[model samples]
Target chain A: MIQRKKSLQCRHVDAGSCNACEQELTALLSKELDIQHYGIDIVASPRHADALLVTGPVTDTMQPALKKVWEAVPKPRQLIAVGDCAAGCGVFQKAYASHGGVDKVLEKPDQTILGCPPDPEKILDTLRELMNS
Target chain B: MSEASRVENPYNEWINDNISHKKAGDVWLALTGYRDGQIKSHWLRANGRIDEVKTACMDAQFASLTPSLPEVAWDEREIHDLFGYHPKGHPDLRPLVRTPRWPASFYPMQKQSDDHIEWTDVEPDNPAKVVEGEGITIMKVGPTHAGIIESGHFVFSIIGENILHLDAHLFQNHRGVEKALESLSVQEAKPLISRICGADTVSHQYNFLSAVEQLAGRKVPEMIEWQRIILLESERILSHLNDLAQIPAGVGFTVAHQRGLAMKEMWQKGLSAIFGHRFLFDAMYQEKLAVSKKEQLQQLLASFITQWHKWRKLADRQQGFHDRMRGVGVVKRDDAEQLGAVGVALRAAGVSVDVRTLMPLYRHNRIHIPQVTGGDVEARFQVRLQEVEHSIALIRNALEHLQGNQQDTSWSIPDDLTGEAVSYSESPHGLNAHVMQIQNGVILRYHVKSGAYRNWPVLAFAVAGNAVADFPLINKSFELCYSCADR
Candidate 1:
């Protein structure tokens, strides 16, 4: 079990992902997972976000846009990388069009959720753990 | 049977005179065939594959076919971008995947290599052509949406609240998967192909493997084929549920959204418990399911239908929900047919182009394709709801037939495979076609035209004359996947 605090607000960015992870993320919004109840909310803007949630691998096309997004969040911002693609570039890594993983553009993430898309429960658990920490 | 088939040159005329005259069905496939300093147009007929062997030259010049077949407009532009074979009279041939930073001389898919590529610093200009007038205002949205969804750029030309025009620019996340699949074997490419669209993993894998199987002249055992159908229906059921759930989400109808998602979660949980993954990424790769486990899964699904009916009734009773969706985002039958819409969009437009019914495969002959006319947001939702019910019935039927069935489910590949084959399957979105060109067991070219790719054009048409406030509801009805379309 982890510590509890104010709800963490997150901004999600799809950097050349297959969108499998996005499905799991959407499921988190559903009543069953209900991440909002657990004090983790998905924010629309990076300025309001406490952390940046990244999915898929960083692509050459999205790299500049991603960097711009990362810069938008205020200081003391946490970066969380979700899914296999964002962690180590997964299947799309080393492709000419992709830099592979969020680290390529944003350096190492504060927390990384693994899986082709980490299950919704796992995502909640990790957030819970991060809250306690 | 082993020889490469050819259509005729001047494909525009051939299509106008011969193929269009047939009117048997719609244009299923359009791809550029690259040979020794020659470009060809390959169109898959309803009956079989037809290749226009010498349609154009290698130099940046070719007669545009988009004038006749508006659907292939995107394909022609993509061909031009990748191979430097320009379609001379294409109306809008701006870079589909390539940004301004990409050097004009560097065409990635060409035989010659300009291997070293870098990110460009060019300021992004609005590629979407906007209408200029006193009241017309261009509103740009996305490449990053408000929710957890894939990226796409939408340029809407609006006068006050009414949308005059909408131009969507996708492929922002194009990972160059086709280039990655260059020398990979059929088995080696399966993972990449399936991942092309995560929600449509099973369908993509099935279509790709079916194409390879056709090329190899191998038949899947009857029972395994039946099991494959179940896998596909399982994918269909869950995917439709997700899309349907979004409908209520778009309108802020939380109760309906929650109910829909509850059913979706219930279904996905059962899928994960029975199969290894929730999405069944490689479940088909397994030889066979244990008989007892199969029975258990069937029982679980049987109970799920009861819950689905109850939840569906509650969702159906929401009057406010129907008000928002009823007449929003209407894509008329003419526009849908002309744009070559597929899946739900096409079905909602009252065209019975369901691949299962049109070209019955495996045990799909036993299934009925449910369609809803009116081409509005409500029609698409109703179509999806009906499809979920149909998929549930299909799964149950397949399970019932598999009671005493025992068949070899071994997945194998032939040693020597050298041919080109095209396979099309109806994904939850629409027709997902995979075109593969193989030589000496290595994949030379791999191209996919997913349902999202075909139906994306319809969105622009649907949003026109609609209010800007209804854009989310309208867009939700189509449920277009930017990654799938981009890929």
Candidate 2:
């Protein structure tokens, strides 16, 4: 297990989402949540990220990209699967185009936030815990 | 088939006269022309009055309709990719939904194809069309972009910062949602339908349920219709507000961007308080709104309008904001009409085409379809701002209609009701249509052609001739959903 850090820099990889999780993730940037204040930043590049925040049931087209993204993230990285789809493919289970979820492609995520789309607060809390732990 | 025995399809005539004679998939092709009011299939199909023209896919190849119907180009390409129905003369028949990784022989939508297939890791040749010439720089943008956005690959050919052409290769988020919905009961498919596109959840749900209800021959109660209208409008408000926020962000107007997002956040919280989901997913399945919740919504909308007016005043005062938007990314009216643009993109280009006007629920109500003539980022922005106000008015009106109307909200599918129908909803992006075919009370074939899918190609048109720096602003102006389009 990777050591807990003071801050977490996450690069979001949308393997194959309905974009609900991304919506909530975008909500984290709102003044109400302002996750940046908590020392957790959703960076642009995986190379600069300490964690990979992945959403969606991993699609066949996205699997290779997801793997490449994971590899691009530097060492001591945590993979947090956001939403039910990322956790276990949700309604998309066994669908032809998808590899099911993040776990199927990137092995197991370090943490999973469950909900059709976990609320902004839940996502923030999970990141906060990851930072502290 | 002899002409004497052949039952003449009015739809065929409608297509021939209005749209195209390309005998590919008439019903499927009609959706592309839907926003222009040139095609009418939803109500007729719902009433079981329209005869579907079915073409046999002999040798898995069909005549391309793209030569005649430029609007149905994407539909034909998608058909080629998913169902293996080759559009023989399709102008640019590179893979659409199918990326290079997907095996050439495997068609996911085909009934005989296995649900799971071995994926190839080998990087194949880039099938994306490249414009090579002197003094032309090719900039390839992401399937995964820098921002918290959905995946879509864009190839821009530029001559000294001015975009010569843009080839947007989308469907990176093709999760086979339609295929997954097949064989599932309407009830089971509800969740997936709502999840098809998060921002357009209510729109997708409205379309899917409308199709299901039409197939089941169930007349939804007025109260439920009003409730759905409120949900859909609320969703519209949220969606438009998001685009509103992003446009300013693209132009680096920090104050407007932050303020817009804050306002949007407030509305999201309000929606969550009333509907249970921030993005309003599965909102239709919720019980009828209580009087208290209705009052809460009224207060929320009232406050939002006040705040919106204040923001609009501030935004209007900022000449720089207007300067950045005005004359940037202009999609001409003629281009918009010919390309079959919908919603803000179409309306901004001076075409007063809104699917909501066609919807029976909104027809009785005072629905003002907003339009502007500029066809630029500013015009689209203005259209959205106007739409937000209209949506608020619509919600308030719907609330008034719902008050004291304690009608039955419960609905069930008729036993063994098996049929196919098309339903359209005017989503914030544009017109979203769902074609559902059922057998034995379960989905046999489920197809969704979202607004984003139709408008995506229009973005390529809008972006060309604009500086690469303005691409984000132009893209944000359209605000097409990648996942929705891909799905």
Candidate that would win on lDDT? 2
Task: Report the poorest 10 consecutive residues by lDDT, candidate 1 chain B.
Answer: B1-10
Candidate 2 chain A: minimum summed lDDT over ten consecutive residues — where? A1-10
Candidate 2 residues B384-451, lDDT tens each?
98999888888888888776755564666766868878777889888788777788887777778888
lDDT of 1 by residue, B1-487 (tens): 0122223343445335424522555454545546343444444455544433345453657766676668877887888777788776689898787777666676778743426676567744437779999978999987776679887778899998999999888888887887777788877887788788888888888888888988988767666676778888899998898888888888898877888888888888898888778888877766476344677777778788898888788778877788878889998888898888989998898987777654345444465666578899999998998898888777777776665546454546875789988787888888888778899899888788788888888888899999999988898898888777776
DockQ result, candidate 1:
0.67
Off by over 4 Å in 2: A1-4, B1-54, B113-115, B124-126, B290-292, B405-410
lDDT of 2 by residue, A45-68 (tens): 999898999899987777777788
TM-score of each: 0.93, 0.92
lDDT of each model, Cα atoms only? 0.78, 0.79
**Candidate 1 lDDT over residue span A1-133, tens digit each:** 2223666788899988888889888888888889998889899999988788899788777777788889999877789999999998488776667778999788899999999878999988887777656
True contacts recovered per prediction: 0.67, 0.72
